[model samples]
Target: MDRRTLLTLGLGGGVAVLALGAGVAVRQVMESRRAARVTGTKLGAPFRLTDHNGQPITEAAFQGRPSLLFFGFTHCPEICPTTVYDMETWLSEMDVAPEALGAYFVTIDPERDTSEFLKSYLEPQSHRILGITGEPEAVWDMAKSWRVYFQKRPLDGGDYTMDHYASIFVLNARGEVVDLIPYGTAADEAKAKIAAVL
Candidate 1:
């Protein structure tokens, strides 16, 4: 082959290689971002609480499976139940085995959400949807450890309202926090994210 022809071919091959490398890099970056959006953080501090059955539960209960956790009270009129319902629907649609995942509802209003109340309230939900509550001090400590915010507001009828942060925590099989989905996360998106982890 002529020298000029050989040189041209070499340059063209180099350019193609570079283009492929660039494409791969872009794809990797996109995938990372998607994973981050689906799973917020990868570390979860330890926590201990009482299950709806009044049994002592801890992060240990979540070992060997991914846990979808949310912090709210049974009395929450709108956001709490709606988010739980969405998670339930999304989890039901997932192809994961039943033993591969769990759902936990941690109550911020430990004062009002007794074991009996939680059991009655969550009866209609899936059995996988476990409810947890504990002493107010311990519950608050756990909330802080999870970086969740909550407060109590007084009402005029000699009652009170509890306002708590609303975010879904996704934990991996080893009981480590992997990601967080906000309250408005779409059902399809949640399912896709969970499927990715599974």
Candidate 2:
């Protein structure tokens, strides 16, 4: 081969290598961003709470399977039920098997949400959706451990409303908090997030 031809081939090969490297780097960055947006924080934070069955639920229950946990009460007319329904729908649509993922509804209004009530409420939604409720103090302690916030507001009719943060937590198989999906997250995005972790 001529010297000029050899030099041209060498330059072309180097350019191709660089382009491939750039493409790989771009793909990695995009995946990282998608994961971050889906799960807001790192997993493995020690969290203790009660399960809907009145059992002593802890982070350990979330172990062995990926979990999607939402902290809200059954009384939440808008955001709580809506988010649960969305998650159920998305999970049903997923190609993954149900055994690979778990869903939880942790109540902020423990005083009002008994185990029976929780079971009744979630029965129609999903058999896999576990409901958790405990003493007010225990619930508060768990909320504080997870950096969740909630408060009760008294109404004029002597009733009260429980105000709480609405964010879905995605925990990995190891029971670590891997990520968070903010309220109003689309079904597709939520499903994508859960699938990524699983």
Candidate 3:
């Protein structure tokens, strides 16, 4: 072949090799992620925090029982309370025994959501749903570990509000993330997801 033809062929072969390598890399990553999902590997890091009753708790609390976790602040005007109520309804409809499941409302606003405050805020809604809060840094660290997002939004007055993830994390008995029931999911759909972990 001429020099021009030889050069073109060499460039084309190089591109083909690069494309093959890229495809292999992508497949490996996809397979790894699929294996993680299938094996139900632990998705959140360990943490130490206090329950609503002022008792110390750890990630170990999630082990040995299916659990549901959601991140929100009590001061939230609408979504937080509504989500908690939805959680109660789903569990009740599913006939999930209180002892058979672990449901936690973890505070994204630790500055205002103390253990006592969480207790009072949660008591009337559902006895089965527990509250979790801790030092601001610790709470934020735990939230980060769980891949939760939150930010403070300034209001006209001196007060402020929080914007945060509103989905419920469904975890299996091994603390593996089974699914996330997004905000506004239908009650029946939520029940089905939670039932899977149970």
Q: By descending TM-score, how would the candidates be arranged?
A: 3, 1, 2
Residue 131, model 3: lDDT of 97
| lDDT per residue as tens, model 1, 5-57 | 42221322221111223223334544676676743243335777899988999
Clashing pairs in 1: 39-179, 40-179, 40-180
Off by over 4 Å in 2: 1-49
Instruction: Quote each prediction's TM-score.
Output: 0.75, 0.74, 0.82
Best by TM-score: 3
lDDT of 3 by residue, 1-198 (tens): 564442221321221111223223334544576676674544567889999999999999899999998888898767788889999988888888999999999998999999999999998999999999999999999987876656676776698877666677788888877676766799889988888877
Which residue pairs clash within candidate 3?
Answer: none
lDDT accuracy of residue 28 in candidate 3: 57
Model 3's TM-score against the true structure:
0.82
Superposed on all Cα atoms, model 3 deviates from the true structure by an RMSD in Å of: 13.9
lDDT of 2 by residue, 1-198 (tens): 664442221321221111223223334544676676743233334556666666777767777888888878887667777777888888888856668888888887889998889988888888778998877888767765665656686766998767666678788886656666766677778888888887
Q: For every model in order, what is the number of clashing pairs? A: 3, 9, 0
lDDT of residue 75 for candidate 2: 75
lDDT preference between candidates 1 and 3, better one? 3
